[model samples]
Target: MFKIRNIGAILLVFFSISLVNAQIKIGDVLPNITLQDTKNNAVKLNSFKGKTVLVDFWASWCGPCRLANRKLVKMHDKYKAKNFEIVGISIDTDKSKWIKAIEKDKIQYVQLIDPKGFDAKSAVTFGVEALPATFLFDATGKLIAINPTESQIITQINKK
Candidate 1:
């Protein structure tokens, strides 16, 4: 009986480790996910397959996320013509507050809402344990970097 219990514990630990390492990694293809905009319009991530995309998960209450938006706005402007896009996914449960933040930040990128916040299935799929998690993918839909900085994004885009 003790041997069986020990074997069960070992299996549980192995599965836990697998789950911890299940996050999408660099070079993995971006999974096509259909989320919605403020107007409830369906938007698919793979719709922008030919453009370099940065999928950012943020919340209105997160200060760091708000700060990141300020920098991302500038980056988007410089690379918009180069087929670059930033998809801002807000996990804020309050729709009004999320919209206000977008306006306050003067964010012109494609904005989507999860509304479920961290409990969202999309959050689990993206393996987002914290706010300001970002995945930068190339024009070919291959992830190039995770939580990339402005310089890193610039370099990756230039490489393509």
Candidate 2:
């Protein structure tokens, strides 16, 4: 009797988890990745240099992410004119559903679609292993916190 095991699959799983765990920390600048807006416009992370930006990694299929969008809408409205912005990078492969979610959620902030789902380049850049993952960055584009609450964003953005 011969026993066979898929070592490649095991290695892949191990390596993927490690990659997700290896994330950029506070004070580290988020890697500049270009994403597409609704109109397919190129939006680069570096373009938001002087604004306090929050990059929210989410998907249309995730309920928590949709729930978080409601709060994010409020935050964006309160801070948009004050040099604060929320860049929502959706990890949804379906553009139509992503747009529907945005419209339904009333997310007025910047909505970018990666269309690669969790395997999107933007997700990899941010090491996003979970939905609703948020990275808060200061005006200088340096990461200040992850999964930051409304209060934290309020405090940090107000400081600038």
Candidate 3:
């Protein structure tokens, strides 16, 4: 009975670790997503490879997203010259509303609209179940952080 119990415990631990390691964790190469920018031009994710990029998934109707955008604006202005870039991906069904929000917030970064809303391919590919979700990628295009805080982003930007 003791041996059987020990085997069961080992299996449980193994499965737990596997589950934790399953998702797109840090250091993973982000998938390339080509989408239309606010100007209706096609933009590829790889275009930002040579710079540190922040890919933010947000929605116009989400209050938290708006708040996060405000913070992002400040961050962008502070680190833009340091090779830091922000790509705002809006999962908004209404193109007009998305454009309006971008103008109202004065977002100076690249803004992309996903007309599929929550079901957007980019959102699904990134497993984004929440608004204001952000992924930070290094100059080499390797994802360095998932859902990082404002300070965390700043720290990464400051790193050599």
Best by lDDT: 1
Task: Report RMSD (Å) for each prediction in the order shown.
Answer: 1.9, 3.7, 5.4
Candidate ranking (TM-score, best to worst): 1, 2, 3
TM-score, model 3 to reference:
0.83
**Tens digit of lDDT per residue, candidate 1, span 7-46?**
9999999988886666677788877688889788999877
> Which residue ranges in model 3 land beyond 4 Å of their true spot?
1-23
Per-residue accuracy of model 3 over 1-160 as CA lDDT, tens digit each: 9999999999999988775654456887767789999989999977898888899999889999999889899999999999899999999999999999999999999998778976888887776888989999988889999998878888878888
Off by over 4 Å in 1: 1-4, 7-11
How does candidate 3 score on lDDT? 0.88
lDDT of 2 by residue, 61-100 (tens): 9999989988889888888989998999998998999989
Error at 127, model 2, angstroms: 1.1
Residue 138 CA error for candidate 3 (Å)? 0.9
Best by TM-score: 1
lDDT for residue 53 in candidate 1, whole number 0-100: 89
Full-model lDDT, candidate 1: 0.88
lDDT of each: 0.88, 0.87, 0.88
Q: On lDDT, who's better, 1 or 2?
A: 1
